[model samples]
Target: YEEPLTGEQYRKLELGPAPIDFDNTIQSLETQSKIVKLEVHYHGHPQERFISLDEPDVSLLSARQLEVINETLERLSSMNATQISAFSHQDMPWKATEDKEIIDYELVFYRDPLTSVREYE
Candidate 1:
């Protein structure tokens, strides 16, 4: 038995942030031009894949920075899970904490994105 409200198996726990109560308005992280750097910024649950951008976002980084990013991306893109997964930033087969075996996903970039951010209201 647990405190507060108890359940036999799983309790409807409010583990993370409360749902946003929107009223005739919406907020998004959309960008028009391009993005210099992008990352997976998430808390509570890692579900940032739900955000959709129509087209690719361009990169506005300098030559050296761009080269580094491009080089890293190229190497990483050509990689397969069986090859390596040391540089992963999120949950993956190499970083799994559950009683799992392997990750059932591909780790590669298909193309060069034109953009990576967007906003809505």
Candidate 2:
């Protein structure tokens, strides 16, 4: 490991003062951030589960589509009893489809055509 630079040393090298103090830097580097494990249960069957990098920085569906995708995946995994079987084209948002529709990501779900219902697989 490289030795920690002193304030004078940083200035001599034309580097700005460290953003964080040495102790804080060590903690930040050594300690892993907390992870939230989420599970979605459907009909008493396991569906999906996942580890979140953070609680989730969510609000804008159009801007942060990846987070939405990750959340959807987690939701699918946590379901206890849904059997999603096949993939339908991801629901791409179409202005014609709805007055104000937002289609960011897509995943498959099991649907009974007869009953017209969907379940997680």
Candidate 3:
């Protein structure tokens, strides 16, 4: 085997700060952010249910509609995940009804069948 290079040889091989590949990073983040895994559930109504919408379907939704879902999720995301189900009324706004407790947290946005306008609820 050949002997190792000297310190001076190694210094010569050192290059200045490398150029940042922002394009790759930005592209990666954009691609990853587009794929959101959402778990949906519904309650209060007599027939509780879960919704399963594919990625393509979700992408068809308007930005505003998605914002509402994101904002709602963000609010809950900041809370203690472990004690989420344990939260009482004191931790939230005044209850408008006794069925306010959330049994499902899946978020789905779609346009009204007739109006064709995006609705958050």
| Candidate 3 residue-wise lDDT, 16-115, digit = tens | 1112343454456456674333444434333322233334556655666566557656656765523443332222221221342321111112212321
lDDT computed for candidate 2: 0.34
Question: Least accurate stretch of 10 residues (summed lDDT) in model 3?
Answer: 5-14
TM-score of each: 0.26, 0.20, 0.27
Q: Write the residue-wise lDDT of candidate 1 on 15-97 in tens digits.
A: 21112322111233333322222445455443333334444343444455555557657766775533333334232322332
Best by TM-score: 3
Better of 1 and 2 by lDDT: 2
What is every candidate's alpha-carbon RMSD to the true fold?
Answer: 18.6, 20.4, 25.8
- Please, what are the lDDT tens digits per residue for candidate 2 over residues 6-120? 2211111111112234455445534665443356775667554445466654553343355545656665665322132212212221211232232221211222342222333
Clashes in predicted model 1: 11
Runs off by more than 4 Å, candidate 3: 1-56, 81-83, 86-94, 99-121
TM-score of candidate 1 relative to the true fold: 0.26
